[model samples]
Target: MADKIFRNGEIVDGSGKARFKADLAVEGDTIVAIGDLKDMQAPEIIDISGKVICPGFIDMHSHTDMSIAYIPEADSLLHQGITTAVTGHCGESPVPVTNHNRSYFRNPDEIKDIDLPWERLETMGGFLGFLEEIGTSLNITPIVGQGAIRSAVVGFSAERPTEDQMEAMQQLVEQAMDEGAIGISTGLIYPPGSYASTEELIEVTKPVGRRGGIYFSHIRDEGDKLIEATKEEIEIGRKTGAAIHHSHFKAAGRDNWEKAEPALRLIDQAVAEGLQMTSDMYPYTAGATGLVALLPEWAQEGGLGDIVKRLSDKATRLKMVASMKTEGFFSIAEWDKVLIAGSSNPAYSGKYISELAETSGKTPYDWIFDALLETRGQIGMILFMMSEENVKMQFNRPYMMVGTDASGMLFEGPFAQGAHPRAMGTFPRFLGKYVRDEKVLPLEEAIHRISGLPAWKLNFKDRGLIRRGYKADLVVFDPATILDKADFINPFQKPVGIDYVLVNGQTVVKFNVHTHARPGVITTH
Candidate 1:
């Protein structure tokens, strides 16, 4: 006897093997049986004859830490069959917030209409407890953020840490690991994390390596110096035994697009030498981040507050503009490629900088500076600089996995406005466009990359496969009709063709609609 059963479906098993027709039964939260279970009796049975059944997707990289807190239902993620999300990516976890680092936490203005009840979570355990109290629609695998740890110890100063400060940082990493963080992550391009030296990173991550935790990094540079950045990342793994996972691995900017092949070879060579390494990417040419990323590192040195004052000072503003002009960072030549994804000003949302510059009667640089001021450095943009060919090249790699690098957003209210389409449509796009349409890889291979591969990378033994005794997290979808409706303009549209999604045997999504079930839990190594 079982609580539920999915009968007569093509089961992929998340193993990258051939699919087979079978019936699977779920008792409580585990898959009790998976085979010819025609004789199995259950309180509820689903007939999925023309559908494909596979383990629920595990998003290898995400930034849903606060977004999940804002909307625990996680409607967008669940609808796409994403049952487990590896959040706290790009070195921006929400936990371990201290008085010194409170400002580093997500501000109230980010999620405009929604009120986050708990603002100052000072520890990993505390943050997990708060999540449990609120309940979630899908499980979360949190990674301690390098930015949060550094900010907690030394504010946002871009200086070498003293001996005592370095020791404090190591203790923080150990404390977070003890509190159930699966690994540690760093966004080397962002402030705080970017300010950290390579030596400092190796020291802080040594504890993670000792505990067999992974090291996930958004490498320092992705443009002209992409290969150099790859070498730096590989050096971290060579020096430390921690498993390395590159986040949104890419070669941005058209001028540096040729670097993609060599950059990947560096990773492949590391793997050939027996270094534990892998990477993840979204099926898109554009990458999203704050507009401040376009500025020189020196302009963003102190922190956001200091940056605002710098922008206001006439002499400093001239210096910043002069630097940008000289460096050709986001110049008019690339202005059209920069799309305004999100901002406090709705008028600018979804419009290109080139278009906005024309309407404002200003240079692209001045228009961008004014836009940053209007939004107070919170403006988000999608830089469409990567090549489609390069993106497909990365997708063909065996070690590559999938991740949205976007937040869990809803389809209505403030959260719905100006969201990246990846947040709503990544998995579906992978299956529909890349697999079914483009015929890049077989369906089974894509499932393994999204499911078993990510689970294996995290060292989770029980959840990524649909074998007997494993957690009953599964998805059933129409292989012929699966489609990602989200586009650049309508970024909040929910995907279609996913029939059902379950977490811990509880139906979270059915008939392509969310059932509002909150059966998700926290997973730890």
Candidate 2:
């Protein structure tokens, strides 16, 4: 709780207004004052020397759930100047609920290692206890996942929930919110969540909506069915009366190239109609996900073992491939578009399906299946299927904000050095490539997208802005040189020129590197 004075820095308060010079005073975890040469004495004084001091960035659509438990300091992200993250994205988290939903898929480590405690999570506070027992690098606020809720109520089966089942699911959401959850998230393309119809979501979201919690989604499809899916999301929000967020927003496929404008228009219309809506997008042309994302929804019905069984059986593989072909999942000719991002078997990293297939003299499908076998269906793939123009168009939209869609891992960890470049590359890429060179948006405006907008969407009061009384989660950076060096082939490379990051008024990262200080806490509404 000692006092410190930050002297002579340009403060971009993240209000999307104008930047101004100020001398800020930090005492304990909050910014006590901001003025010119305040008549105050502090024990420590740091001269910023005219750098831009902005609020800490928030990742709205992040998936940094388990990684933070291992490397709690989060050197990679904090060095790039992020202080807050929203995990439990795209469904599923170890939230304390109950035995019915808790008996879903196991983590690869837990499945391969111990007979760990498994049951319904009764409270968010209990889950927070688990996190506190471990630790984290940045403030983490979680969204109650619809997939986890569905699993607790109905398992991964695609059948509609009975009345009692639906009621139980609604009660679970109420309990989670009573403890801490800010909102609810759904990954419709993934599992039990993808199988949920509008009616089911409305019933589940009723408790969430009544609690003033937000409802976020990854929607049913990201490629062909996107426009309708977005509209469907809006409809759900309208029905439930919950603020909506579209996770990892993007436009993909040749046919969907023109969908961005209409899609954005639809969002704007929804906003005009008094529905609150916002979205987060990664700054990349490709999208990353589990390799099984290409499988027909029907093929992935029963879960990991089912998918593995289908992959192992030649007849089932043929049936799956035919379904994929009919659905235009990968278009046989474009098989090279998929590259391995990570695998339990590290030998497959960076190799494309086409390259691996050529080596074995088999089709890309066979190569993917073989790799799936080796990794036990835990392989991650980066699909180079999005149009760059479509991507830029979405980024230029004002409502679009920044999200890493990645974890807070080091160059080496359970997450290997080069997995998804977005992990270390997103914020810097926004600053260096787009803001500075491409003239995509004004620098301050871009900063707002990464910093303030996300905080606003999640209703994080008194954070994500440089103002008196707000938490002093701030970053000082050199605008001219900030950039991300990571690429698809080298995903974990550190970004350059982010000088200092303060999380919750703690200098967790200083002089452009991690202090390896675990100062983060589990944040709640």
Candidate 3:
């Protein structure tokens, strides 16, 4: 007898094959049987007669590490049918915290409500242990963050690491891999990680290659330097032999919209050359990041205190503004396209830079500087820069997978304030808008991209497919009615038509309502 059985559902299997009617049984945390199981007996039976059952969606790239400690329920993620999340993305992780980098490990303003167990999270092993102790709502696959490693050893300095420092960094990477991290990640556009030269990156990633771990990167540039950045990533893979996965691959800015095709061609060429290369993307034209990204790189160095000092200096502020103008900050014509997504002050939430600047009777740069200073550089902004045509083009690629690039959050409390719609709607929006409405991809192929492709890339042994011995992580949804309701203005709304979500054979979501079950485990490579 099985614990529960899903009957009369069309199974997609996350294999890119045609769907077929099947009855699936789950016992404990694993799928016990699949196929014609008319005689199967279970204490609980779900009649999913009109729904499609598929492997739970895997988020290929995410920053859930930053918020999982606070939002362990992961309501937004579970509601969207995400079963496993590959976190520590874009060069940020909570592990390997050292005295030198302790203050910078996580933003204090973001976690003012709860106390984190810092001592239990200083290492990858300890972090994983802590997660298990707390229990999460979805399986978490953590990766070592290059930025955090650099911060721990190099302390956010742009100066090249000493030979001893470089060795220390390598040791940290090795330690993380040994502690069950799947691979290493770099946020090349962020500080500390961005300060590393290409040679430094190749050197640091050597241990990952030796361990057969992947090297995931949010490349150095996404605008005017798109092609060059892509080439740099390839060079790192070529030199280090580490499998490469680009995070939230995009060509930002109006001038670089067409660069998406060429940049992807580089990936194709690299693949042809035998360098393992893949990419993930969210189904959105706009992207969200810290407002401080608008500042010049030099101005972003050091810690928050140093950055505040620089912002306080009028001469330095003027120089920064000039540099941003010259480099095309935000890469859009009007500041209105840049909306305030998150901030310490709620008044700024949901307002655009243009509106705030106009109301304050100040220049856009001045308003930004004032906002950053007032919030102490803790503001988040959503930039509307990418082209929808390019987004659809990327979605049609065979090598591309889907990622939310947003953290899990509930629809209430501090977590919901100014959250990106992608946090709650990426999967449904991709399935609803792209696959169902526009026909960008067949449902079978699209399901594979979100499930099987990521699972294979991450080398998951049994998950990501609805196989008889695999972990019982599954979702059942109505193909015709599934649609994302979250939008830029009202990002708190949940999607509709997802009927059930099971994590580890336990129902975490039923009919779009959270069951508050924390059955997720720390999945390691």
**Which 10 residues in a row give candidate 1 its minimum summed lDDT?**
324-333
lDDT of each: 0.87, 0.79, 0.90
Please give, for residues 205-323, the per-residue lDDT of candidate 2 as tens digits: 88878878888878876777788999999988999888998888876776777777788888889888988898888889888888877888888886777777888899988988888
Per the 3 Å backbone cut-off, how many clashing residue pairs does candidate 1 have?
0
lDDT tens per residue, model 3, 295-377 = 88888899788899998999998999878876645444359789999898989989999999999999999999899999998
Which stretches of model 3 miss by more than 4 angstroms? Answer: 106-108, 331-333
In terms of TM-score, how similar is model 2 to the real structure?
0.95
What's the lDDT for candidate 2?
Answer: 0.79
List TM-scores for all candidates, in order: 0.97, 0.95, 0.98
Candidate 2, run of 10 with poorest lDDT: 113-122
Off by more than 4 A, model 2: 96-103, 107-123, 328-333
Candidate maximizing TM-score: 3
Instruction: Extract clashing residue pairs from model 3.
Output: none
The parts of candidate 1 lying over 4 Å away from their true place are 106-114, 117-120, 326-333
State the lDDT at 468 in candidate 3.
Answer: 89
